[model samples]
Target: MGGNLQAEPGGIASFSISVRNTGNTVAQHKLTCASGHGWPVELGPSQSSTIDFEPLDILEFLPMQVRLRIPPVTNGSPPAGEVDMITCTVTSSNDPTFSHSEYANVTVSELKVFSTELFDLQGNPVGPEASALPITVETGETVNVSMSITNIGNIEIPLSVKLQSANTDWGMYLVYDGVIEYDRVTFNLLPGHSTTVQVTAIIPLSTFDGSQNAFSLTTRLDEVGTNQFITNGTNFLVGKLLGLSLESSGEKVQATVGAWSQYSLWLNNTGNGALNLNWSTAEPPPGWQFGIDSAPKSIDKLVSSEVSFGVIAPNLAAVGDIEQSIRVRVIGTYYNDSVEVFIDLELTVVPTLHFGLELAPETSVHDLPRETQGQIVVIINNLGNSPGGGNLSAIIVDGEGVEDPEWSLQYEHSFDELQPGEEISVIISVTPTADAGSGLRTVEITILGQADEGVIVTTSEVLSLGVTAESSTTAFDLSSIVSTEVFFSIVVLIPIILFVVVRRMRSSAKIYDDEGESLVAPGVHTSQENISERRAAALMEDVEKEDDVISGDISQFEIQAALVQSIGDLPPPGPAPLPTGLPPAGLPPVVLPPAVMPPAAAFSSSPATTAQDITVNIDDNAAQGGVIGSEQSSSEPMPEAGQQNVAIAGMPPVPPTGLPPGWSLEQWRHYGAEWLQRHSGK
Candidate 1:
C-alpha cells in the first residue's frame, strides 16, 4: 500500500500495489477501479479494463499499478489542507464473495490571490495626477481613503495593509473607524473577487506644510513575500511666496528743435509681493541735458508711481530735420526678469524764399496813332536769400475791339535766370494797326515763378495803353469832307441873295467908283511866261532843304522790339504821300529784286554763288519823309517767311538798324551770336 499524496483539482494520483497468495494455496484474484479517478482503469498484463481471476501460485508475487482521479472544484481551488478519499478492492475468484478493500486520502495545494488599488471617499479613482496622497490638510482634519483589494490567485486569501514611510518625520496614522486605530488594515477575499475598504488618515496640529512620500504595503496570509504597490508624493502649496511683474506708461514721444520737452513715465507692479527694480537712462546729445526726477527704487504690490524725464535742447542742438531715440533699462533680481524700454524722440527745421515783380513807373501808358509803334519796360526781381528760376509769359488779357494780328503785340519775354537782389528788364512793344479803332487797352503780364526745386509762386500786373486812328484812304471819314462843302456853299449863297433883294427894292445897289483901280488879282500872276518860271523856282528850293527828325508818340518800337513774325505780306492799305513831306520829283524809284538760290546752298554754310556777284548801289540822296505807298498790286506771290534771302552783296542794312556794324571779326561774332537766339527761345 502507498501513502496518501496531494494533487490539484481534476488531476491524477498514481501508486503501486503487490498481491500474492500468502496462505500457501493456489488463489485467483480480481483488480477493479473505484471513484475519485481521472481515467478508467487499464491493466497492463491483459490490456483489459479490469483484472479477473488471474492465477496466483503459492510463494509468487505480482505487482499492479492503480490510479485515482480528483474531481473538479467550481468557485475556487481547494486549500492546502483540504483532502479527499480514494478506495480500491481486490476479490477472490474462487469461494465467491470473499474480498479485501483499501482506502487512501489525497490533498490539494494552491496559491493565495493578493492585489490592491486606491480611490477617494466619493468612489472616484485616485492616481498621481490627482495628487490625493500626502495631501495638505489643516490640523485635526481626518480624510477617508477608499481602496479596492482584488484576488488574482487561484485560491482564497486574506491581505494585511499598513501605512509605511522611509522618512521618520512624516506623522500620520492609518485608522479603520473612529476607534480602530492600527498600523495596518486587514480584509479577506475569494478567488476572482474583490472588496473595498475605507482607510482613514489623521494629521496632527504640529504637521509641517511641506512634501512627504506616502505608500501602502500588502502581504498575503499564506505567503512570506510583501508588495509595496501603493505609492505617491505630493507638494502642498499654501501661504505666501515671492512673485513679481512690471509695466511702463508709453513707448514714444515727439519733440521740436531748440526746445525742451518732458515725459511722464509710470511703473506698475502686478504681483502680490513687493518689487525692487534698479533703473538707468541712456546718454543723450551733449547739451540735450537729460534728467530723471526722483525715481523710487522700490514699489509695493498693486501700486503705481510716476517718473519724469526732460531733454533741454541747446540753441544750436539741431539745425536740420532728423530723428533720435533714448532708452531706459530696468534690472530685476533675476536675469530673465529684467525689463528694458526705449523712448523715441524726434526733431525738425526748414528754409524760405520770397519773389516779387515791379513794373517800372507802375503804368507807362502810350498815346500812339494807328500804324505807329511804341514800347513799355518792365522789371522782375527776387528779394529773398534763395535764388529762383521760372518762366515768363505775356497775355493781352483784355481790350474793346479786335486786336490786329499784324501789329497787336510784338513778343512775350522770360526772366527765368534771375538771382537774389537781381533785376531784369523786359521790353514790351506795341504797333497800333493801321485801321485800329480808338480805345484804352489793359494787358496782364504774368510771371509764373518757381523756387528751390519746383515750388510754385505766381504774380501779375496790368498795363494801360491807348491808340488813335489815322485818317487815310483806307480809313477816311467822307462825312467831314461833305460837311465842309455845305458850309462854304451856304456862306456864299446867303450874301448873293441879300444883294439881289436889295437891288430890286432900291433899283440901284452897286455903283463902282472907278478912281485909279490897280489890277493885281490877289497878287496875281505877272506875265504867263513869268508865272511858269516862278513855279519852277519854288520846287527847287523845297527839295534842297534838310530832313528833320520827328519821333512819333510811340517811338523806336519797330527797331527795338525783338519780335519775329513772317514778313511775306506787304504794308496795310493806306493813302498817298502829303505834298509838304514828299521826296524830290526828279529821282527814279529804287527797287531791290529777290535773290535766286544757288544750287544746294543754305544760308548757314553756303559758299559764294552767282547771287552774291549781283551788286546793289544805294543812292547818295538822303532818306526823306515818305508815305506808305498804296499796296503795289502784282500777280506774283511774295516769298514765304523761311525762304526769304538776306545778305546780298553791297546792300547796306536798311535805315542803319541796330548797333552800328563794325567790319572787325569780333563785332560780327557778337552780332551773329544772337542771330540764332531768337529762333531757339521759348
Candidate 2:
C-alpha cells in the first residue's frame, strides 16, 4: 500500500498497517517515498508494517510500494495527515504459492513564501517604475490599449489582468483578456515570460467642441487565488467652430429752363464694402440744362479713399458740392434745389402786330360795267404770337385814278390771343358807279390798332376796270336826220342815172350791124342815130298784125339770139331754106297754126304807134337792164334833157350802178333767184 500525507511546518506524522495472507503462501514486498520526504522502513512477504514522517519547513517528496497476496487478501487505510495513498498485492488461490506486495508513502509540507514581479508580452521585467499606457484619439475615434501580464517572482504563481474605463459615457470597453480563467488565472513564471492583454474605448461626437474634453483608462492585476491591483491614464482634446455679410446707394441732381444754365450733385455708397459706380445724363430741359462733366470716379478696396471726392464708409458722414450759373435774363421763378428755392431774373415782354393778306381768285379788270359787283377774299394771317385787336378800313379808287368818297368799306374785330401760326379770313363786296372811267382801280385795306391810338398799317392792291358805251334806239336830232336823207337820195339817183345811159348805149349797139352800119339808119354812123334806128325797128316789129304773131311777140329763140348778139356776135347766117317749107337763110324755121284775132271792138281804141313805142321802150329797158347789171356800168352817162325819153323810160330807169356798197354779185344772184321764182309763180 502507498500513502500520502500533509503537514504544516515543524510537524511529526506516522502511519501503521497490517497485511495477512490466510492462504498458505510465501510473499515478497518493497516500500518507497517521494524525493523530499524521506522514509526508513522494510517490508517482508505476507507481512504488514508501519511508516513514520517529520514535516519539513520546505516542500518534500514521497514514494509508494505495491504488494501481492494469495487469495483471501485484506487491506487498511492510511493514517492521519496523509494526502493520498495506493497499495497492490498478488497471490495463488488454490495452494500456498509465492506472492508479491508493493506500497507508497507520502508526506505533506509547507512551501517557501516570495514576492511577485510583473513583466510584459516581450518577456521583459516590469519593475516598480513602469508607467501606465498612454493613448491619443480624435472625436468619434476608437483607440486600443494593449498590455501584458507576467510573473517576475521566483515561484510558480497564477496571475491575471483586467481593463476598465474611468468615464463610462466616453464609450470605453475591454477588447481582450489574457486570463482564460476567472480572476485566478493559472500561470507559472520563471520571473521573465509574459502574455499580452488589450482594452479599447470609442470617443463620440458629443465628447468635445472647440474646447478640450477628457477621459481615463484603468487597468488591474490579479494574483493567483488573491485580490486585485489597479492603475489609470488620462487624455484630453480641443475643438474649433465655423462663420458668413451682405449691402447699396441712392440717386440725385436735376435742371430746368430760360437761357443757358448749369447744375451738379453727388452719389454716395453705404455698404459693408466699397463699390464701383457708373453714370450718364439724359437730354435737358427747354433752354437750360445740366450734365456730367467727367467720367465717374472710382473708390478702392477700402470704403474711404483719398482718390475719390468723398469717403463713403459705413454710417459715416459725407458732403458734396454743387455749382450753378446762368447767362440770359430769365423771367420766371427758377428752382435751385429739391427743396423749394426760387429766384427770378430781370427781363422785358413786348407787344407788336405782324399780319399778311392774299387775294383769292387773283385776276384783273380794266373797267367793270356799271353796277357790277365783285367778290374780294382777304386772308389775314397773323405772323406774330400776340393777338391783334384792330379796325379794318377798305378804300376803293376809281378807274380814272380818282378816289370815290362813297366807295369805301370798313369792319372791326377784337381778337383773343392769336397763338403762334394762327390766321383769320374776311370777304369784301364792292360795286362801281356806272360813270367810273376805264383804267386801273385800287382797293386799300388799312388795319388800325385799337391800342395804339388809331395808328394805321396800310396794305393796298390795284384792279383794272374796262368800260364800253351802250347803244340808243330812238333819240335823234334834226340835223342828223336831214343829213341821212340826203345821203340816201344821192345813193338812189346815181344808180338811176347809170341805168338810163346804159339803156341808150345798148339800143345803139343793137341797131348797128357787124359792119358798123345802122340797120334802120342807112349810112348813119353816129351812136345817137343808131339808137333812134333801133327804137324805130323795135316799134316796127311790134306793129305786125296780132294775128301773125305766134308764141307771143318775142319767142325764146329770138330772146336767145338777142342775148348772144348783145354779148358778142351771132353765128354766120345758115344755108338757104329747103324746098317746100324750110326756114329762110339765117332764120329758124317757123311753125304756123291757125291764128285767132282779137275782137274788132277790143282793138278799136288801141293806137298802133302807141303800142309800138311802148313795146320798143320795154324791149330797150329789158336788154339794157340785164347787160348793164351784168357788165359796163362805168361806161354809161346820166341824161340832162329829153323829157320824152325820160318819160318813156319810166321811173327814169334805175342807174347802172356798181354793186350795192357791201353787196356782192353772188348775193345778188341769190336775191335774183328768189325774186324770179316769186314773179314766175305770179
Best by lDDT: 1
Model 1 CA deviation exceeding 4 Å by range: 2-14, 19-32, 36-83, 89-101, 107-159, 166-182, 186-195, 199-214, 220-682
Q: Rate the local accuracy (lDDT) of all candidates.
A: 0.47, 0.35
Q: Which is the leading candidate under TM-score?
A: 1
User: In candidate 1, residue 122 scores what lDDT?
Assistant: 34
Which consecutive 10 residues in model 1 have the weakest lDDT in total? 560-569
Q: Distance (Å) between predicted and true CA of 444, model 2?
A: 4.2
Which lDDT tens digits does candidate 2 get at residues 1-682?
A: 3445444323333444443434334333223322222322233332343332222122332333322211110111122233433343443333345455544444434322223333322223434424522233457755454445544332334444443344556655443443332122333433334555444556677766433433332233334454554443334332211000110121222111111122323232222123344333332223323333443444322133211111111111011222322221111111221111112121221233345556655422324454565556666655432444555666665444456643434344333434335666666666655543333456766554333433222222222332221221235322222333565887789999999999999888844345323342342112333344456655675455856755548765456435534542222247422223222222121221112322233223322222112111112454543432222222343222212221111111211222223333322222322222222222
Q: Which ten residues in a row have the lowest lDDT in candidate 2?
A: 240-249
My TM-score estimates for the predictions, one after another, are 0.22, 0.19
Report the Cα lDDT for candidate 1.
Answer: 0.47
